[model samples]
Target: MAGLVAALIVGVGLWWSSPVSSGDVHRYVTEAARQQQIALNDGSLVELNVSSDLSVKPTAGERRVTLAAGEAHFAVAHAMARPFIVTAAGVSVLAVGTAFSVRLGETGVEVLVTEGRVEVARDPVDAATSGGGRPKLGVGERTLFYATNP
Candidate 1:
């Protein structure tokens, strides 16, 4: 019993001290009442709206995020090699160095582009394999994808 307790304490210490790991463990940013801002490892900035939930997964080649609820604004760093992607509902919004906002509503997911351009696709895997050419949205453009649409 003493040995087990010591091992558990060591495990907790390791988990607390390690900020970056080899595995692609997702980091989360959740807001309940007020807006929250977070700076990502790749120089991207995220502004989470009230009652929003966002999970970030950074891999060797890509930066990925999932918008679970509410809305958030993303200002991605300019990196052509590493694309930034946000998955909400069944849609994927892909961008490289752009500013955009994603809002999850009761009926559908809405994507608004304020700067640069973004691509919206039904399947992220297909979007990646197909050169991410499903449908592109430019600045001042937006799209809504209903849950029943895809």
Candidate 2:
């Protein structure tokens, strides 16, 4: 009975520490006129701006975040095996270990890299109308992606 109790305690401890390891999806939303900060399971940090909506999912191969609306700054943790990716509108930003901000606006999506580097690309379905190119942005660089109508 003592051995069984010890095993159960260990299991519960592991589960509580890494709930996202079970493929859980975490969502965060910021209220209007307010900002919020979120710490991801992988040690990354995100600062969500006012009226922003963000969803985070950790998969076996990568860490993904979807910005449904508003803006957010990402301070990604370094995990070479799993790349960090952020998607907003039709644009995708890929970063291995970087700090960047993505904003979804009325006319387009804007990406600003404050540290490290990131690869910005348009979704394949919108490639034709948006052009084709994977632009790499370094620290202090910024790019604007025009919104496309489906």
Candidate 3:
């Protein structure tokens, strides 16, 4: 039917206009004593510090990054509808149009905000072992999260 065809066309158009239409995974890593900078498809920028590992996956609704090790700085793009979330060592840092850095250490994770604000929360799985409450960090603010069991 013509109605069905029109609806299908609209759906395809919407999908094409999305920030990230496909589930593509991007990985970035740095060697010892070296640093790397990455520019994401969504216009965000990431700086990986020495011996760091990072992965980025932007879905239709959110831009997510995982810090497997070391430290990285994020200069997030302004996407109000899609929040930028960085996860490291059971901690999640959520930001919108902000800049910050996250570091994973042997003891725990550290977050430093240089611009705007970010909300830091512990993953549910690590709640029992995570100490301290959820904190919102603004410019020039920083926090360190330590595992209660560690």
Report every candidate's CA lDDT.
Answer: 0.80, 0.82, 0.81
lDDT at position 142, candidate 3 = 94
Candidate 2 lDDT trough over 10 residues, lowest sum: 124-133
Give the 10-residue window scoring lowest on summed lDDT in candidate 3: 124-133
Report clash pairs, candidate 3: none
Task: Give candidate 1's error at residue 57 in angstroms.
Answer: 0.6
User: Of 2 and 3, which scores higher on TM-score?
Assistant: 2
- Give lDDT tens digits, candidate 2, residues 30-106: 66756878788899999989888788888877888889999999999998878888999979988888999999999
What TM-score goes with each of the models?
Answer: 0.78, 0.78, 0.76
Off by over 4 Å in 1: 1-23, 125-127, 130-132
**C-alpha lDDT (0 to 100) for residue 130 of candidate 3:** 28
Q: Which scores better on lDDT, 2 or 3?
A: 2
lDDT of 1 at 119: 85
* lDDT of residue 2 for candidate 1: 100
Q: Which one is best on lDDT?
A: 2
